[model samples]
Target: MEKSKIWVFVSVLCAMFVLVACAPGSGGSPTPTPLPPVSSYEKSIFTVEEGPIVEEKQLMGEIVPSRQEELFFRASGFVTRVSVKQGDVVKKGTVLAEMQVDDLLNQLQQARIDLEVAQANLAKDKAQREYDIQKATAEVTIWKMRVADAQLDYDRAVGIQKEKALLNLNIAKENLALAEAALKLVQENTNPYMEQAVKRSQLAVERLEGLLAERQIVAPFDCVVLRAIIRPGQQVDAFFVVFVVGDPSELIVRSPYDFDLASKMTDKIEVNLYFDSKDEKGYTVSYLPNFLPVTTNKEATTTRSSGDYFYFSLPKEIQQQDLKVGRTVFLKVILGRKEKALLLPPSAIREYKGLRFVIVQDGEKRRRVEVNEIGLKGTDKWEIVADLKPGDKVVGP
Candidate 1:
């Protein structure tokens, strides 16, 4: 019994020792203290810089004719031959195309027949006028003969009357009056016939003038043929687009600019262009025109650039192949610039109003700084032009 009691006491003592060893803070070995919580505030720094930043604006435009014109057959005819093809250069009155003269010739023949008929009518009318004049002259001669006979009778009557004999003097006077009436009637007819002949001659003159104008097809202006809308032997009308002609010298590049960006630009702004179809060294600088073009955003890639888009003439490229009038090319324009400006990640700055501000860490204190002349440095980065000194802390992106 005594040995069992001693063994039981020993086991109880050993269990109590294990409990004391496992208990918190009982063993001499130290407990790891919880580390202090880290503060949530952290940021970066930048220096206020003085340098240049190239401020630029990008715009898109199209190649267009100085003037685009749709050439058509002013009159009707089968196109006999097309002397020009798409992309052909032509001069005014160069006869880029010709019509089968068959119809024109037929019309000419008809016009000639009409002219002949007019001539014949004119001749007939003239002849009638001459005949009427001759008849008037003959009638006047007959009247003069009758008047002379009446005068002789009147003289004989007057002599008889002077001798106190009964005579018919009144009847002689009435005969003279009737002859004058007949002469006036013939003269009136002759005058009317001459007037009618004059009218016919005037009509003939107008018909000849119209026919001459129709026989020639001439270009109205200098232009490049963009497309041949008509083929040989094809009959075209005044409304048909026979040739899409444009003056290459009139070609201009058109580009879209963001509206907000465009508002900041001035007239005669400088721009650079790159032609995908041409070499990169072909960069050309052009000035913006005095007036901005009216445009709608519904047709553009974005609605924001409607009033911001513009056009520039490809003054030098007009002579280059593939840079023809009405051919489109790409363009870029530079608006403004700044030099060697101190910059920070745009993410580091907070923009408000027109002014940009950044939070700088001064030891443990955070201070707000106003950035002047904020310029773009790169994607999502900006250079601040204001009061940041070197070694100043900034909120980093």
Candidate 2:
């Protein structure tokens, strides 16, 4: 029995030894552990650098003609010919366009005929006035002769003592007085009539003169024709804008700005503009020009709040080539620049309740640093107003 018990104990000891060989050891050259998995998000370490920091402001604006004018026709007529075209430069009184004055000519001719009739009527009035004067003179002579004859008959009858001849002579004197009174009335009325006819003729001539002035069209100042709205022989109304002429030298740029940005920007602020052309030119603030209020789409914007925005005017840069009329552009206004600023990647800084913090890694330990005035230098980079020591490891997720 003792021998059998010894054999069983030996077999169990062998099994215990096999189990010990399969189990892992706690110390003394333990198995190497695997490192934790790395995160998929992109990250960067922040380091201190010296120099001025340039803040690139991103804004949207438009290219507009600095000078624009709409040429309007004040008189109604058929357009006879358009002498100029779009993009043509013209001077003052240069016939940019001509109109058919045939209708106006006809009207003027009719007015002239009316004036001639008035003159003829005036001449007839003058002739009648002369005839009235002659008739008045002849009546006065007849009256004098009758008076003399009556006097002679009255004296003879008085001397002969005849009542019948004396009565006839008295009646003749009274009739001569009545004839003189009628002649005076015609002289006064006829001169007034003749004067009125002369005034009517003068007024008719003045009306025709005004019509002739309307038939001629002339430009008021030197400008370029921006648009040609009419062709030859096209009937146009007086209210229609025919040619759009504007001063090219005094051009201004019209751009819509964000309402919020407009407040931040002063009317005195200038900007650097980049054009699509090979040469990116710039312009400065010369004039505020005009302000226009407009509404924006809520869904179309990502940065601006919904409300009215101001459309600002900018000075123009004239060129020989036809400039882009309606195109969006980027602008950078110089607000301020800081030299020898401490900069770090924007990812390195974290914010909490308006306080900016940066996680610093030092030999397996993490600490937080507070900073102020964290200006953005570039994409994913920032400028801090605190001391960012060089060679520091920045931590972020």
Worst 10 residues of 1 by lDDT: 294-303
C-alpha lDDT of residue 180 in model 2: 83
Alpha-carbon shift of residue 385 in model 1 (angstroms): 4.4
lDDT of 2 by residue, 1-397 (tens): 9999999999999999888877877336676799999965334555656567666455566644444545545568877767888777788888676676666677677767866777788788878878887888798788879878877876777555557767777777787887788788877775566567667767766876565445444555776666677888888776456665666554444445555455556666656655543345665543252442111223222223223333445544545353454456556666556776677877677888988888878777878878868774655567787645766677763
How badly does each model clash, as a count of residue pairs? 22, 6
Model 1 segments beyond 4 Å from truth?
A: 1-50, 70-112, 116-219, 225-244, 264-267, 276-282, 288-309, 315-319, 326-328, 352-356, 372-385
TM-score of each: 0.47, 0.46
Full-model lDDT, candidate 1: 0.61
- In the range 1-397, model 1's lDDT, one tens digit per residue, is 9999999999999999999999988858786799999765543445444455665554555665645555555567677777778877878877777665555456556666666766676677768767766766676576667656655665566554644322333454465566567657655654454456556655655665454344334555676776676678777664345566667664566665455665655556666776664546556656565433322223222212225455565556445676655445666566555656675666777777777788877778878878777556544446667787756678653
Against the reference, the lDDT scores of all candidates come to: 0.61, 0.63
Give candidate 2's whole-model lDDT. 0.63
